[model samples]
Target: MDKDISEITDKWKNMNQTHIDTDEKIGPYLDKYFMKYKKTIYDSALSLFYALDTRNLRKSHKHEPISIQALKCFKDFVDRNQATIEEAFLEQKVILPACQFAIYRESETWISTICKYYHVESLPKADRIRLLQKTVNEKKFSSAAWFAIYAKVIREFNLQDIYVPLICQTRISVVEQLMKQDPAIAQDVVACMDKYIDNAGELASFARDIPGANFCLLNDKGIAKFAKRLAREYKVPIQICPRIDYNAKMNAIKFLFRRRYEQRKPMDKRTWETMIDSVFDLDSPASEDNNLVLELIYDLTNYQQYEEARRLAHLHRIPENKWPKLLLSNRSSPDRPLSRLGSGKIISDRNPKLVSVEPEKYSVDLPDDKIFYINSHEKFKEMNSYITKHPLLAIDTEWKPKLGLLNECNPKAALVQIACQDRIFVVDAVELCRDSEWATFVNAIINNPNLIKLGFSIHNDLRAISELIADMNIETKPESFIDYAQFHKSLVQAFKIPLPDYPASSGGLSKLAYTVLGKYLVKDDQYTNWAMRPLTTDKIIYAATDAYVLLEIHEKLESWCQERAINYEVLMKALLKKDSTKNKVNIK
Candidate 1:
């Protein structure tokens, strides 16, 4: 029998060498040989050897997609031989050695098959003793080999009945050697055991026996669930220490686990308790553990379980001083002030360094019949003159709402409208430039210190204008203006005012107008050629209304602030600070 086995092994080895060296199709040859010696150890070993050879060769180019035909053939062979393989193990024939080689070669597939056939009753005590002895003798197998065998055993037999003792004994014998050679593999094995096993006492005994096994594999959700389970099982409180680095990943896993388990119906609670207790027994708390705590608090806050979050915070002894900053949630509003310091009353006593200025004055003299284009240099001059006359101008711009390309170049800036008391002048930049009388108006508005600019998101217009006229100086002062969108947002939050659903960052002038004024302004010519020589009446009206609405919105928001005694300087400062972060704009 030994001589015959040696001859078969040599033939198989030569065949493998030939397959490696030549490009001949080897699948048919393997199938023919495997079928010819169906029940023998020779057949089993040859089948496993061929399958592993094929798989390894393919794995060398692992990224390439696997051939479906080859996979199907391999899977079919495993399925057909599964019962025979298990029977061979039970009979302790020459097939046992072949089974060991099969496990090492196609570890994943063989383990999966074994797991499916695992039945304690089917395995007679004599066979079990023989298999155990084989496992002990082959204990020098690689970690990958052990992992494969362990996985199969766990899957095949009831873990409570068979796997626990076997794994414990295996670890006792090989853990020290495994740890010495590859500490990470040892740690991963311990973690896997901690996660799946259900006996805390057994796990603790194992860990105590194996020194430096300090890490637990429980994720955040696992930790929470495990902590709760331990409290119920042991009738004692278990403090869960957050391992922050791993918490997020663990939380994701726990969520998936809960979802899967719930779908599967009632699980064993005792099993769950054991698993949780075993995993968490390795935890130790640290000061940097606030992120996980914060995440938990945030989740609780989402569910409006504020009291529970607060209690957890207190019990954890988290610093109370940082609570306000950590716990506070920012709500979005359409016209919410972008500045953090740009809301509330101008307290003269507290913030004396902050400056307050009235809106710049400007006069409008364009005839109603004449049309003006927004981007015209001449129109800018006339508007500048009007602003100079009044020294306080309500500056605003008009552009296509959704057209990105048009807004990028020669953007129409119509209705350089000036408001003084009840009078509003729409200084048409295009029409005024045709007469060359707009330059003085433009100069006056540009040069005036007392002419404070007022608009919503005026920084954009300022930038646009700066690009249009190379030397134009728009007052970039943080306190020299009022951004109505930003002011309104702060007002909404501070006064608990109801706001529409929109991103906190989205506070376009048009949206603000629609929300605050209940009237929709037209922008028919917004996407029209702004640089076109002829301007339409509809376009002029659209441009004019853009600025006109700003003057109105500004007055209403200002009055609203005054009525509430809100400090405008503080609000502006907050907004200015926020804006500063955005563009690195110098506010001085």
Candidate 2:
């Protein structure tokens, strides 16, 4: 181990030295450290190199004592030791910051060295341009060097036509950095980009690749021109990546702001008129019968144009039926045909049905009062009265735990839905905190051991809820509870129940509910903004059903356990003693 550590340290020192080092020599060091102390040493070295490089850059700038002769000497040293530098950079021996510095300071040299070292005689023109642009803009390389590289690639590869596409996809910071260093090169690249790639979609994709390409600022005239060009170049119904599309739209908006800021002029009358027309054109009219309005709302919402989104949503009454389909459609591709059809009809492979079961309907009567939206004392009193009357509460939470700020670490729970025998209460936890009475009422339900709190995998929900209320000085009892998962697993094992053919491990409480109770629960609103005001009917229904289905599932599982003479107490005890330690084995 000592020998291994010494060898690793020596290799690192050689790599970081002023002169270049050989990969053959450094290889053993990298292998030893990466193999021995993979995460710790590697990460620490990378971080240290980054900080040192930044410090060096700042120091070099401050102490301009180094003459042109010294600079040339340093350049000569780099050139002479090019092989070692190239090896170190390629092997990632220099760490990220130093590597970035090398890319910025000596991109052409690095690229040439890398190509030669790898025996890659030629690279795709677009890739070459991308690399050059990334190095120039991202690493703050000189404009002269950037243009020199750009010109050489274009001339050597005969890539004049593709230059615009490359430029369009190049980062704006690179452009700005190049312009700051040398405006002539920046102007040339901009001109090249403007000359080619006339289509909006292509332009959008290009802008998407570029760090700061804005698509939203393309005025009516610009869009009309691009749209016309796109029609000529590509087929109708163009497919685009949603993330890229979103970025392009954002960029366009930024472009508008930039135009206003730089040009110091208001939008022209024609442009203003076109903006209104374009927005309206994007909206669905009664005659079209399409959810164009909804699309517009989605676009506006995504762009954070809250007022415009709300206005369009209201104007269209954005039918709830269309929203889910539209949202899913935007995210995923239309299904492809399966080899065999259940009905025995040989379906075409081009367009297959993306089948998802329609959510099941429930007949439980809920109060007309919008308890989810309003944080009122009266609403809390009414909800508390309802819960007390039917104290046997079935609780569930609908939250995108993975989507929260903390994500894997500390996830926030929202929309704590509780169902009694008949009524279902979709409580907005976000709003509930605002009302002191609502908080008090929720605390009562959480603390009451006599309530018989039932849920499938209620442990997670309990943990999350406890963490949330911990700030309020409310201590929740972790002991008194029932877990449906443990109970169901026990019954399945005891009876040797036939498992379904689907992926065994993937199915959780929802699948268990479907298998046991023969009911489908809606999970659509599970990821929705449960904290949003004016909770929709769909959200309410989805939330309520989650808790309600758990109640039914628990009852069914319990009865099945009893019938099979499964030890319910043992199962409960096993669940209670279940190891919280992630890597530890559960002895129970």
Candidate 3:
């Protein structure tokens, strides 16, 4: 026994000397210490662990037999190597062993480490609860340590055997911490506590022990029976039952605000106050829906509570754009549209801001020999041949204008016009959508890497194509496509052109044609129903012009960009990158 003790002490001294002389890493020192003193190192291991720089042990690691000093030391390690430790802990193999170490240690810090490292789903229920129990039971009843351990145990191991008993015995401080950590667990814990307390007298006794036991937090999930029992016992009726269902309250508030706005219903101060009180709880979450909150701010403007409205806006985190500043600025005046002439209708259209182009300046007389109407499979094959022959094709889709109520109309493409050099083919969308051959041919063209598809507002056309494809249960996206609208924007930005301002998704065929071809593409039949069969000659020519003009504009734009020393390839790539980013879902 004396020999073993001497050997352990010598190993510790040597380890310390090595550690001090050359700042050695922890893993290497531990490896050597255990190897040399493997047989009798159990008693001296803690001392050796303490002697070395404890900074090597990451916070994610479950360092056993936790002391205040060790915990403090481990915290520093956690701070320094957080990302690395977190990454390693994410591995499935790493979690089990770390959790096992935490269990063996029977430590509050270790249990927390497990919770931090492994998700509840990743952990085995039996092992997690067992470790939780070991750590929690080892903690002293009334310290900060106990509160932390109890909270972790309750959160991590909510199984009835472990959770119910611990929650019933736990003091209010620990319960409060648990509630703050996870309100859902607090709900469960309160329910369990109520079950154990049984009669009103016993519950009152528990409440007396901890005066700050706020039972209001647990006023959810039919636990109202327990709350009512306690209230009856106290004779004050604490009014904890029928707790504010936040989501339902928000929905109601949103509906009311919508009605007030749409119906132009004047809401009185008393009614507004009642609406606010129903949704707003001083103790509960203040901000639920920013839209409804913004509406509430506007309503508050009617009440002349400007400062209070601003304060509420800030609390709800409503965006600065939605602040109702204009409404607030004109709060005293009657809300009505002003016109130059009294009782006269407001003419919305003013003088055209865009530079007008003559049709004859850029009109091309199409050779009747090349332009082919491809409605049948035979014409489609001939069009496919033309598509294969050409490296680039200008494409356009015309859809029937969706009419009627916004929600009732079904919109679809009526014409798909493809222009390849000399040949222009107008495929009937309604007829072509039914043919499997047409689907395969269309897929080939759209997905071809060698062929470039040129269009104006390409996303709109793509969306129309996607909708049509969905009807046939075929999914496709144009692989090599350029939106002239996107290109024009990038060109203006890159070349510093002094052109008239054109809104995004609006700088379409007419704008491009006017800018590049020096001619306005006529849009007389633009909104006409393209889905009607026995199509007009004027409609066919209109559809053909829209497709053919894209190629002309594209060539002109490319040449114009290249002449100015702008890297056309790099510029298009940048524009496409911007387009792709713009298409991404903005989640707010």
- Of 1 and 2, the candidate ranking higher by lDDT: 2
Among these predicted structures, which one has the highest TM-score?
3
> How many backbone collisions does model 3 have?
0
Give the 10-residue window scoring lowest on summed lDDT in candidate 2. Answer: 400-409
Model 1 residue 414 CA deviation in Å: 6.6
TM-score of each: 0.30, 0.37, 0.41
Q: What is the C-alpha RMSD of each candidate to the true structure, in Å?
A: 25.6, 18.5, 17.5
List lDDT for all candidates, in order. Answer: 0.42, 0.46, 0.53
Task: Flag regions of model 1 displaced more than 4 Å.
Answer: 1-386, 389-392, 399-420, 427-443, 446-449, 471-479, 499-507, 523-525, 567-588
Q: Model 3 off-target regions past 4 Å?
A: 1-364, 403-410, 471-477, 497-507, 565-588
Number of backbone collisions per candidate: 43, 8, 0
For candidate 3, the 10 contiguous residues with the lowest summed lDDT are: 236-245
State the displacement of the C-alpha of residue 25, model 1, in Å, after optimal TM-score superposition. Answer: 74
Q: How far is candidate 3 from the true structure (C-alpha RMSD, Å)?
A: 17.5
Best by lDDT: 3
